[model samples]
Target chain A: MITLRQLQCFAAVAECLHFRRAAERINISQPALSAQISQLEESLGVLLLERTRRRVLLTPIGRDLAERANDILKSVSDLEEFAHGARTPLSGTLRLGVLRTLGPYLLPHFLPEMRRRHPDLKLYLREDPDDRLLDELTSGQLDLILMASAPRNDDHLTVVPLFREPLWAVLPLGHRLAAKDSLAQADLAGESLILLEFGDGLREPVLALCHAAGSREHADFRATSLDSLRQMVATGLGATCLPALYVDAEALADEQIVVRPFDAPAPARSIDLVWRRTSARSPEFRLFAELVASHLPTVVTPL
Target chain B: MITLRQLQCFAAVAECLHFRRAAERINISQPALSAQISQLEESLGVLLLERTRRRVLLTPIGRDLAERANDILKSVSDLEEFAHGARTPLSGTLRLGVLRTLGPYLLPHFLPEMRRRHPDLKLYLREDPDDRLLDELTSGQLDLILMASAPRNDDHLTVVPLFREPLWAVLPLGHRLAAKDSLAQADLAGESLILLEFGDGLREPVLALCHAAGSREHADFRATSLDSLRQMVATGLGATCLPALYVDAEALADEQIVVRPFDAPAPARSIDLVWRRTSARSPEFRLFAELVASHLPTVVTPL
Candidate 1:
């Protein structure tokens, strides 16, 4: 029978591709780690790794098996988390994955308070790109995730809508649009717009807005972050749209840039708290989501 | 011959996994794109895509071939860029990849000046994680990259040292260490250090510093960006290290946070401008490197 320990050892080795480092990561002796790998291979009747003097590489089938092993390991971890949650609703460690765009701006508004209220709850935070955040949550590496957009109809997950953050137009101080109280989509036509790269959650909606306004994304620049987009705008490179929470957190005080709202029926993204459908901590998660919504900055409307 | 057009059409399809969207992305008719894919597959004598009414999927070998086709497309793009560069030294488009950690803080200091000096030059910027930046540069998706550390002894690239930016300890107001004039590694012992997540160029160095000082990273938190780290510190989560340029750019005025330099032999990261050795525009790139080094903020030591 395949044991969870074997899968854990194999997953570690697959990630590091070095037996010694993998052993160190898992807090085991080198010989013990090697023995488990060999034992698993013998039992399965398939070679999993190719070892050279200087490097370790996975076989083709080994690559596919490693992915499966990781999935199994994630399920086991989720089971353990379920057992822990049964004993204590919110006291144990909760691993949370978050979108890079939302984490920085949103967390500061509520993290300290959350920590104060649940002193026994330890939150392990990992912020990543949107796709990776979903991947990690599905793999059970994260107990929950906070993102601007949830999968439309993912059957395997539960999503709690937290808030709606409006996208505001940001421009250099002397730009022609800066004089307007609230810029309409048509008002932005013919302007040079800057945006985040394709994979960023904010990019598509911002691109759609630009397209609606007849504005073209600057052919020469795709910012990596909201901060980068702001920096470019400050340098007079191009105008951009930033979320209200982000603008409130950092840009409100910047004299070099101007932040204005869009006309009614403004572009906005829905922030969600998502977790696996099979999670045992659903009740606690719902309560936690309520807490987040209650404390959200006034710039965003709670869902 | 497998024409570039066929590969372009196939790569687009591989990315979108929908023929209509792929055709729209590449500005070709759906039938025209489908014809190219079929002709290419026939010549190669392999089924590249499995098409059904609802969706498209790549075959196992098709996935690998698609990656290769994309690489070839990138090289072709680079060849065109080379020809464009040959016509005018700095008048054409230049695609530059930048590290997310460095771009926001560093670019504003020089980008406006760069635009002023080279009016005809159109600079396209893409900011990505460290590994992706290097991969894109090697694949010819980017002509140049600016990063904290260059790959050592890489035969395929030329690296120009830019400057050394010191890491500073940031703390909440009224914290125990906030009163100190400067801090030594020993002073950080027993402190909880917040850090960027793994894969960020700055994370490893910050972790090393934490290790050297007997400090332990806050296991519960791994920030996605430097700004996120700052926000966490502001909320009294823990102390963190940030680059001097970033501090100079954003943190100096924050009333809730105090930034301090490290003691003698302060830990720092080396910034470099890197490009493929085979690039035809070395002279122009070298001149661009000089201009960047010259305009670096006073907080860093230009190399």
Candidate 2:
């Protein structure tokens, strides 16, 4: 007996926490929204909202139902989207989640080609840590993701290897390491290394490389982003490691930051395009992945 | 620039993958649904669906946009839900994601009290692995969670320690060790142990206990759930260890499985109620946690 319209009204009112504002959001008169809420409550045999002079509140039942209603409405919306997609494979908006380390350097090179190929395609981009991006990907909040070191073992995911980019030692312009033509792992011995926070996918391996080189991590500081890490190095904070793509795209522009590659046995992270295995857009995603992989080496040399 | 109505219509159509079925899903006449799709495509300046005499398909762009539109609509719905909830606090539905290992043996005992105290509160429950549950907790997909080994170090999470539960060794009723009134760590030496698959929070500690006892995990048979492990022991399979609460509530019901406590220095897993620190429903969660803790020991003896 419940209707989407009633759920919409309830969601609107609950979100606005104001009957008038909710009514405005849904493009309905305030009394009309109130009537819908009453009808929903009556049908469910539970009170969903408690209206005071100053605020509108959701009862416990209201909260539960609102959560379920939101899921249902979203599912319904997803269904329609899937239907439309089946009819026109390359013409709508694409929501992409990319790694903070990879997106800035990677997307600019390939997205223009993607736009050229599918003139009607619109891209919505988000950049975050791999853990957060993968979480949203699994939850259907993100359509596809570009990430590093995807767990190939996860049966629920499909991963397309895009490129493997080496790690570069980022040093202040005039540092001893920067002046060297090339450096071996032993050359970094006793060096102070600063790195990104733990969850970024870039951190663990970078830490491992530093430890292997007999370098110690800076005890007091961990940068939140690659830009910040570069800034720290530029200001003579400490030397650090970054992916080659990032150094090429952003760090090279900074005269104070010098990027140098490891002499041999260089460490690199594999970047991949990953998505839900069950997604209806699998073919399209695969095609997009291939396009990106083919063009990647032109902008950032592949491993 | 996309409106909720257009997105909703698009989602419905995408789901059914058939124009008539999609229109029926939204309770609209097929022609009207078609008109709305046309209008949406016109506004977006792109063709969203491909129509043939017999079927409908999505352009690549259509698929991308549909996914993005779905997320936007869901966000809008969530915003509405949040606003309403701020006014009422705890009276709305509570979505609780609980660990598969703990929920069954724990919730039934205290849920009656939860119902009695806040009859208006509706609990929507999901049981998943700890990693998945924690991810959902952070992403706003779940309201609260009951899990083991709360990562107290995470500043974004607020954890309420409920109780500590001990692990019990389970064996067949007529086994030699089952005759003993109590068991010690050394008693399990040279014994064959069966365990749950890796990733369940219980696996690591159980493996450590086995190693301490000089026992090796059974290589071929890994039980998927506590009930399966109990059944294996009942049928004269290898012995296993389980939480005290699980042994009390579920394993004891089987006539052939015997549950025993350790002599001393028992290994235990701490159980806690966790939610996002920024959750507006913090006060309500705290009160609910208190109520559950008060009723806990009656059903599951605390360590």
Candidate 3:
């Protein structure tokens, strides 16, 4: 039988893809890595690697097993994290990753309360786009992800929907259409629009609807960041679609902007708290998720 | 932090109610169960159970926590099942529950093949209605279920569809509808139908449509078992709707019976293998499920 240590060693080595580098990453001797890999192969009755001292490459079967091993190792790690997270007063490292766009605005609303409630929870926050957040979350680098509902594939993460925020058109207060009571997709056909690129996670729904309506604006301004999109919108450059939660009274203090209903058959984005289902930190994340989902409804939704 | 052993004891005691019965159930002394309950209360800083020589009942918080404890225990049981299933090939007590209507026809067709394939799998085959099968599946008594899609409250189980079996209308030889190349819903609405009832699991869909169309015919007979249904149909009692897979070559060999296409948005049943999502048995059950799902396209729809 292969030991958990062997699985850990193999996973660390497989991830880094370089023997010496993998050894350095895992803090193990180079020969020990070689021996563990060899021993793991001997136990499993399958050759896992092809090493020539200079280059180490995974065999075909080795590659498949490595992927499976990663899942198993992750499960084991999640259970360990679960045990560690089960302490009474909640004193431990909690790696938090929030999507770049939502992070700046969301922190003001929820994190303050979370910190106040659990002062002992040492939260290490990182701001990144949803894609990187998802990748890091799955790999055990991050415990929780605060991102928009438009996740393409959510295989590893258990998604708990926080709330559905109705789509509101964000535009400069001085724009001609801003004065209108209600705006429809057809109304924005000739108007200038700004949208985030692919990785920002809001691009698909924006592009899909625009394509469906054959909009003529062609998204004249593209911003890689959500904050950048907001900054541009504040400057009177173009209109953009955004969730209603961000433009509440406090957020509105940033700039003079008109938020209007986008008409019938409108779109809504689901803001969700997603964490890897196998994370031992899941219950902790889940409790936190429930707190946000239940409590933040009043402040977060664009009622 | 509640120890797993304490939760197990609490659950057993809760189920048994009598201290001695609970002790016997857990193979522990009565004093130990009482001790663990007291220790659990000490850890939580609250009384969990109200106990006496005569009876045992939960406190308000205990009752509330019983719900969460059930969830946690279910999760743990699923994890153990998953681990055990992964380690061993499908063997031991495999409690398999299948729908009543499908059970007879399906088991005869595939059981022999399945037995030949997995000799170690001791199939404790059960023929039940969908509701019972679903209940048993959720309670962890039944490892896997073969049933049609229905609205089941499943927070723990994962339902993955195996295949969609198209419905075929079976009729007596030289019947008016069978002479036609195809039959529509309208053609059979007013005819004497051998419709399966609640235990047959088709009560809802069949009744819903017939009721909506205002064309329900007075059924001459209803049978709990498929064998009786097949015999009734063979003897020209009334026409019945069945998936193509169950009406095998042997059944079609009946000179007095005929099969025809049922038309106008064909009625189909989606068969799936349902198991606990967190089950340790998932990995092996998935492999077994895959074999069945793969063999199913040919077994169910008829190539």
Give the per-residue lDDT of model 2 (tens digit) for A1-303.
456788788888777778889999889999999899889777665566655454555654556567777776676566555545434555466779998878888887888888888876777899888999999887656778998889899977899887777888999878988888767878889988898886667887787888788998988889999999999999998899998888878887888888888876877778888987766567788888878877875424453
Q: What fraction of the true interface does each of the listed models get right, in terms of native contacts kept?
A: 0.00, 0.10, 0.00
lDDT of 3 by residue, B58-131 (tens): 54345445555555566545434433443456654467898876666666656666778777666788888888
Model 3: pairs clashing at backbone N, Cα or C within 3 Å: A82-A280, B81-B280, B81-B281, B82-B279, B82-B280, B82-B281, B83-B280
Q: Which stretches of candidate 3 lie over 4 Å from their true place?
A: A1-303, B1-86, B108-117, B208-214, B297-303
Off by over 4 Å in 1: A1-303, B1-86
Task: Write down the TM-score of every candidate.
Answer: 0.37, 0.40, 0.35
**Candidate No. with top lDDT:** 1
How far does residue A94 in candidate 2 sit from its true spot (Å)?
1.4
* Candidate 1 local lDDT, residue B48: 67
Q: Model 2 misses residue A124 by how many Å?
A: 1.2
C-alpha lDDT (0 to 100) for residue B219 of candidate 1: 84
The clash number for model 1 is: 1
Ranked by lDDT, the better of candidates 2 and 3 is 2
- Residue-level lDDT of model 2, residues B177-266, one tens digit each, is 998987998899988888988656798888899889898898889999988988888888889899988888887777788888887687
**lDDT per residue as tens, model 3, A61-110:** 45556776676555544433433343533345567788666666666666
Q: DockQ for each of the predicted structures, in order?
A: 0.01, 0.04, 0.01
